[model samples]
Target: MHKEKQQNIKALFPPRPEEPQESDCCGSGCSPCVFDIYHLQLLEWKKQCSDILCNAGCYSKTSDGETNEPLLSPIKFSPFQLLSVQQHTHNTFLYLFQAVRANSEPDQESAVTEYTYVKRPLGISVGQHLVMRCSSDGNQNTVVTRAYTPISDLRASNVGQFEVLIKLYENGKMSKYIQNMKKNDIVEWRGPCGNFTYMPNSCRHLLMFCAGTGIAPMYPIAKSVTENDLDDTFVHLLFACRCFEDILLRNEMQQLSLYWNFSAEIFLSQVESTAESQTRYGECVKKGRIDKGVVIERLAGKTLQQVSILICGTKSFNKDMINYVKHVGVPDDNIHLF
Candidate 1:
C-alpha cells in the first residue's frame, strides 16, 4: 500500500478525547450519555473506514475468494463558500456552494481585481463524494468533518454551483452546525472520491440499490446515463425508505423517468395509513423492499456480464443485497459496494 493509503487506514478514526466515566455521572438523568453519543459516532466512523478500504481494494477478493493487492491514490481538497441553503424535506436540506479559487496574482494589487476572483468549477464525476470540514466557533479547536455526495447535476447548465442533500440527525454535530450556517460561510472541502466511475456505454444496464441518503450519490449516475444521448445505456434504481415523506429527490427522479430507457422502483417499508392499494404513489413505486423477485424480473433477459450492480446502505443492507445478487450468479467484479 502507498504511504498515504497506509496513513489513511491507520488514521481512520482519530483518538477520542477522554471523557468523564459513567460512574461520575450526576444523579440527574440524561437522555443520552456522552459515552453513548460517542459510541454512535464511532460506529459511523468505523463504517466509513471499511467503505474507504473496500473502495481502495484493501479488502477486495478475487473470483477464487483470495485477497488481492490494494490500489492506492490520494485526492485533493479545496475551499468553497456557501451560496444558498434550501429545505428538501422535513429533515433534509439542500446546500449550494460556489467554489473559491486560489489566488494566482504576483502582487496584492492585482489580486484585488474582479477577474482574479474567478470561481473554479468543482471537478467531480458522476458518482463521487466530497469531504466537508466545519468547526464550531465556541470550540474552534474541535473540528467535525463528514463525507457527503452531491445530488445535483454539475454538468448541466449550472456551472458555478454544486448541490448536496444532507439529512440532519437530532444529535448530529455536523448537521446542526450546517443548519445554522449563514450565507457566505466558507466550508473547506475536498473530493471526487469513490471507486465507481460511470463511463458512457460501460455496461448495458446500471442497477442501483440504495436507501435513505444513499440516493445522493446514485442521483448523478442515473442523471448522466439518461441524459447522455451518445450512449444508449439503461438505468435502474431500486430505492427504499420508511415513508414517502422521507424520499429525497422525488421531482428529480420523475424527470429522469421521462427518458426512454430509465426505470425506477420506489419501495416503502411503512406505507401511509391513508394510502390505498389502488392509490398511485407516483411512477414505479411498490409497497416493500427490493427483493430477489424484483431483481430477477427487471434483469430477466440480460447477461450477468452486461449488468452492473451498485449498492449503498447500512452494513447489513449492503451485505444482504450483495449475497442475494451473488447467489443469482452476478460476478464479484460486476458488483460495487459504496
Candidate 2:
C-alpha cells in the first residue's frame, strides 16, 4: 500500500524543462525571450508539484477533464471567436475577438429562451502584449506564433472583447494566416505578457518612438494616461511612416492630441510635403525621418531623471531610436523596448 502511494505521488510530477540552445534564440530582442518562457514554465511546474503535495494527490478538474483556467493565461492558450474584421489601411487590419463561453446555460429570468453570459474584461495592463498561434493549412505540424499588443481602451467597461492591429507583410508566415481568416473563425490566444509596468503618474513625461504598426503598445499607455482625470503624465509621441496615409490609428491619435498633456508628431520619410498634405496634417507632420534633432527638441524642457523613454519598431528602427536617445544622456534603465 505504501509503495502504491509513492507511485501515485511520483505520477503527479511534471517533466522538467530542458534549457534552450543558443541557436534557438533569433536574437531580435523579443520581450518574452525563449529563456524567459522556459523560466516561467519552470516556475509553473514547481507550483504544480507543490499543489499536488498539499492536496495529497487530489486535483481539481472541470467538466471537460481540464483544469479550470482563466480567460487569458501565460501557460495555456484560450479560444476566441473572430467577431469582426476591418481593414484600416492597405496592409493593416483590425480584428475583434470575443471570448468563447464555457458551458453557458440559458437564463430563467428572461421571458425569451436565450443563453445569458456575463462579460469579463480582458484585463490587459497598459503596455502589455499577447501571443497568437496559427498552424499551416496543409501541414498541421507547421505552427507560427507572433506577439501583438491590443489597442483597445483598458479603462472601458467589461465587454468580453479586444482588438489587435496587424500589418500584413508580403512574405510573412503569420501574415498569410491572418489574411485568410473569416468571421467566426477561432483563434488561440494567450497573454497579457510583458515586462513593462505603467503606474499612474509614475513619471513626469513619456517620450514614445514608434513606426508602422509598432504603435500598438504605445497607444494604450498614451490613451490611459490622457483619459485619466488624476494622472498628469505628459506624452510626447514621435510616429514615423512612409506617408500620411500609412499612419496607423490616425483618427485615434488626432483625438488623443486634443488633450492638453498629449502631443504627437509624425515623420514622413518617403513623401514630399505638398500644400494639401501640409494643410491637413498641419505642423504635426514633418517631411523627414526622426533624427537626433527631433529627439533633442522633444527632450528640451524635460529633465532626464523625470522622463521615461519607450521604443517599438522594426529591428533597425529600434536600434536607431535607442542610440539616438542614449546619445542624449538618457540612461539605459529608463528606456523600455516593446
Candidate 3:
C-alpha cells in the first residue's frame, strides 16, 4: 500500500541525471565528481550511446506479414472535455478533469509530490466523484465513470485537473484516439471512480507489487505514508519491467530513502527487470521478478496482520501474484487487489 505511494513520490521529484552546468549531482554547485550520472540523463548523446542507457523494451521480431498475429495498433483515447490542458513535455500532456460525484467525505485528501502540479475540481467536495459523460469517437456517448481515489494534492489551486497515466496498447482503440487529440478538442468525462483506495492506519507495513503503467495508484497511497510521517511503518515495493532501462523515475525513487518524517523512512526498491519472454518465470523471477520471498526475508518475523499487500499488473500477472500470496497464507482481507 505504502509502496504505491512511494512510487508516486518518485513521479513527483524525479532526479535529473545531469545538470546543465558541471555541478554536483544533487543539484549542488560543487563541481568535482566521481560519477557524472547527473550529467548523463540531461544529455541526448548519452541516450544514443549503447553502453549507458536505460529503456523499457525487447527486440521484438516484427511479425512477418504471413503470420496471423492480430494487427496491433499503439493508440488509445478516453474523452475528457476540453476544460483545459497543459503540456509538460513534447511527448507528455496533462488534461484538467471535470468528473461526476460518487459520495462525500469530511476530510478527503491525497499526498502529492513537489512535482505533482494539478487542478482540483471546483465546487466539488473532497471524496465527491466528478461526473462526466463517457464516450468514444463513435456514436455511443455513454454516461459512466470509473472512481479514482483523488490523486490530486490539496495544495494545488487549479480546480480542474487530476493525474492519469495512459500508455498505448498494441493496436488499442482508445489509445489511438488519445494520441490524436488536438488542442481545444472538447471531450466529455464523468466520475472520480474506482473502489481501490488507501485507508490510513490499516497496517504498519505495506508491500506493493506493480508493473509497467500500474504505478499510478501506488502514488497517492504511498504519499499518505511519507507526507503524514508514518515513520514506524515500512513500505516494500516490487516493480518489474522488461529491462533496467524501462524503470520510470529512476532518480526519483532514490529520493524516497529519506522521505517525509512520518512512516518508517521508506526504503524504495525495484526488481531490476529483464526480458521475461526470454526467461521462464522461475529464472526470470529469480533474476528480474523481485522475489516476494526476498521481501518477506526483509521483514523477518513480521506478522501478516501488521502488513497489507497491494497487487497491480497486467491481467495475467495480477492473477499469478494474487494466487502466490494466497498460497503463502496471507488472508484475503490483507491483500488489496489493484
Candidate 4:
C-alpha cells in the first residue's frame, strides 16, 4: 500500500539516490538544515499523494472507446443518485447508486434524446473504495467525506451500479447522513481508493482473518477468487463477530461455497454454541476467540511459501493476530495488515 505513495512522491519530487556525505554537510550551526527540510517536505508529499490516490479511478475503456483514461476524472467529485436502499442486517444497510455526470447532454447528431436513467459506470476494482461526501448543515464546502469499499462485483458484468454495505452507529456522521437519505437523493462520490489488488492464481491458498465489519473488503476478494474458478486456488476465511446475528452476508457466502472451493468459520466471542446455532450454522460456528490451536489445525500441512494471509479488524485484533502468527513461526513477510 505504501508503495503507491513512494512511487508518486518520487515521480513528482525525485529523492536523492544517496544522502549527502559528511564533507558535504556544510555545517553552519543551523537549528534545522537542508536534510531536515527535505524530510518534512517528503512527509507532506506523501500526504498529498495519498489524497490523489483516494480520488483516482481505475484504467478502463470508456463509452467513447478511449483507453487508459479514468472514466471519472479525479479533478471533481461526481454526483450519484440513490436508486434504492435495503436493510441487510439490523444496523447495516445496502445503498445502491447511479452515477449522474454534470453537463451530460445528448449529442446534437441524435434526433431522439432518450433520458432513461441507468446505473453509472464506476470503473473500479474489487478491493478499491469510494469516497462519499455529504453535509449536515447543508453547506457544500464544509462537507464530510467517508471511504467505503463496494461489496459488488463491478467487472463481473460491467453494470452501471455498485453496492456499499454501511453499518449505522450512534453519533456517526456519515452513517447517519446516508441512512436518512431518501430515494433519488444525489450524493457526491469519488474513487477507486486503496492499494490491495487480487490476481487469479496469485497464490496457492488465500487466508483471510477479519472481525466484525472488517469483513467488508474480504467479501469482494473471496467473491472474485471464487468467480475466477482457478484450478489450484483455495480460500479460507476466519471471521469473528460478537454473535451469530452479527454475521453479515452469511447466505451469500454459503451460496458461493456450494460450487467453489471456499470455506468459512465464524467465531463468536460473546455466546456459546447452542442447539439452534449448531443446527443452523453447523460446523461454521465456533465459540470463544480465534487461537493458535485453530490456526495451526487449519494450516497443518499447508506450505507457507504458497500461502498469503490478509488481516483486517480492530487495532487489537490485528496486533494480536500478527503476534500469534509470529509465535507459530510464520515469517513476517507472509502476514499482511490491511
Candidate 5:
C-alpha cells in the first residue's frame, strides 16, 4: 500500500523544465527569450509541486510556517533597486543596482516596510549574462524583457552592487521603460546565464571580434585574463564601430591596451582616415571595416593551435567574422559566437 501511494504521488508531480542552452539564444534580444520561457515553466512547476505536496499530506511549508523561496534564483525574478545611472553616450548608459532583501520587516514607527540591502556578489561567471524584465503597461500582462551582460567586476570586494551598460534604441520597448526609470525604482532581474567558460591560460592567445554593444560579455573575460598574474593569455581585441565617437568603453579599452599581453585596434567604418585623427588615436585606429585583409593581418603571427576566437555582433557581422576566420583555417571548434 505504501509503495502504491508513493508511485501515485510521484505520478502527480509535474516534470521540471529543461534549461535552454547558450546556443539556443541568437543574441538578437528577441521577445520571450528562451530563458524567459524556462522561467515561466519553472514557476508553473513550483506551483504544481506545492499543490501536490499539500494533497499528499506532506510538509509544504518551512519551519516558520512560511513558504520557502531562494534569495536569488536564475529561474525567477528578484527585485533590485537602481542606485545610479550614468550616461555614456547619446544612446548608451551605465546603470548600477543593488539587490533588495526579500525578508525585510516593517518599521515600528509606521506601516511602511523598510528595505534592506544584501551585500554579496551576484554570483555571475566571467562571461555570463542576465535577463532584465520590465512591464510596458501598468498591467502585468504587457511585459518586455531583455538580456544584458554586466561589465562590473564580480569579485567579492565589490559585493551587493552590479553594473550594466545599456544601449537605448529609439523604438525599443525595453529602452523606453528603462529611460523613464529613476533612482530607487525597483527592477526585476534574473540570471548569471550563459555558457562561456574561461580558465587561466586555457589558450595562448584570444582573438575577440566584437561590434557595438557586443563588447559587454567580451570585456569581463578579457579583464579577468589581464588582471590575473598567472594568466599568460594574450588578448587581441578588434572592435568595430561607426566612428570614434561611437566607440563604447573607449577609455576602458585604452586602459586595457596598456597591459603587456593585451592589444586593441579600432575599425572606423564611417570616419575618413586623416593625419590628425590617426595621430590622436595612434596606429591602432584603422579607417575601414574589418574585412578579409584585416582578419588575415591579425592572424598572421598566431598559429591555429595557440589561438581561440570569440565573436559577437549582429547576425551578419557574426556570420562574416566566422567566414573570415574559417577561410584562414581556424576550425569551428576554436570559435565561440556570443
Candidate 6:
C-alpha cells in the first residue's frame, strides 16, 4: 500500500495550506495510520545507524527450539542487513509515533523523560552515518528528534555521545516537543541515516548547497574538510531563504567561509519582490515561488563530482530542489540529499 503524503513526509511536516482539512474524511481511522507515520521516523533513524559497529545484539531473547536447549544466538549482520532493518524499523516507529501523539497530547513541559540505547554504537567514519539523541526542548513533556552528522573527527575522538545543533521548528511536532524538554529527560535516538556522507579525499572543489535546517549535515562535512586540513578543497556554498529571519546558523556557516579555501554567497532573490515572474523565495517568502532554474544558474561551472550538494528542508522544499538539480544536468549520482 502507498502511504499518504502526510505520512511519507516525516521530520518535516507540511504547513497549514499543505495539510488536508480535518473534514477530508479520515485520519486516525486508517486515512493515514499513525503506525505508518511512526515507521517513517524509525526508518530514517535506522538507515543512519545501520553503519554502526555492532558486536552484540541489543536485545537477546530466550527462544525455544526443536533441540529445546538454551538457544543462544550470536548476533551478526552485514552493513546491508543493518541498514535495511534500520530503515524499516525507523519508518514503522515514525508512523507509530503519530498514534502516540494523537492518543496523548503530552504536556508541553516534559523533555525526554525516558531513555533507551541500542545494543552497540558504531565507530563512525568518512562516508559513515551518525545519529545523536539529545534533549531538544526546555520543557520535559515531549522528545524532539532530528538528525545530524557527527562533526568530531571519528579517528581522533571516538566520542561516546553524538551532538547535533537543532533549530526549533516553529511549533513543529518534534521541534515544539523538544523546545520544552527539561534536563535529564532522555530521547531515544539511533545512527546516521543519510546517504549524504561527504568523502574528504574523493573531492576537492566543494559546492555545498542548502536552504534552511538542511544546513545541519553540511556543517559537519565542511568542518571535516577544514579541520582535517583538506586545503585542496575550495568551498562555495549558496544558501537560500526568504528573509534573514528564516535563515539558520548564519553566523556559524558564514564563519566557515573565513577559511582561506572557502567562498560563500547568500541570495535573497525573493526578499520582497520578484525580479522575474517565476521566483521561489520571493512569492513564498517575499513574493515569488522557488525557481530551480535560478538556483542552477547560481551553481554553474563547479566540479559536480567534487561538489557534494546537501539539500535538507521540508519534504517539498527538498524534493523541488532535487528535481531542479536533475533537470539542469547534475548527474543523479552527484547530488546528495541529507
Question: Which of the numbered candidates is closest to the native, going by highest TM-score?
Answer: 5
Scored by CA lDDT, what does every candidate get? Answer: 0.70, 0.77, 0.46, 0.70, 0.77, 0.45
Q: What is candidate 2's CA lDDT for residue 184?
A: 79
Q: Write the per-residue lDDT of candidate 1 for residues 250-326, one digit (tens) a residue.
A: 98888888889788888888875425653344576678877777777767788776688999888877888897888
**Which prediction has more favorable lDDT, 5 or 6?**
5
TM-score for each prediction? 0.70, 0.73, 0.53, 0.73, 0.75, 0.51
From the highest TM-score down, the ranking of the candidates is 5, 2, 4, 1, 3, 6
Question: Which sections of candidate 1 miss by over 4 Å?
Answer: 1-77, 101-117, 138-141, 156-160, 272-282
Candidate 6: global Cα-lDDT?
A: 0.45
TM-score of 6: 0.51
Could you report the Cα RMSD, in angstroms, for every candidate shown? 16.6, 13.7, 21.7, 10.3, 13.7, 18.5
Better of 2 and 5 by TM-score: 5
Q: Compared with the true structure, what per-residue lDDT tens digits does model 5 show for residues 296-325? A: 988997877558899999999999999999
> What digit string (tens of lDDT, one per residue) describes model 3 on residues 3-103?
56534543443343433342424555445442343334433332232111111111112333232221111122223334455543333344554322223
Q: After superposition, how far is residue 287 of candidate 2 from its true place, in Å?
A: 0.4
lDDT of 6 by residue, 238-263 (tens): 66666544555555665666677766
Candidate 2 root-mean-square deviation in Å: 13.7
Show the colliding residue pairs in model 5: none
Ten contiguous residues with the weakest lDDT in model 3? 51-60
lDDT measured at residue 126 in model 4 versus the true structure, 0 to 100: 69
Native-to-model Cα distance after best TM-score fit, residue 109 in candidate 3, in Å: 42
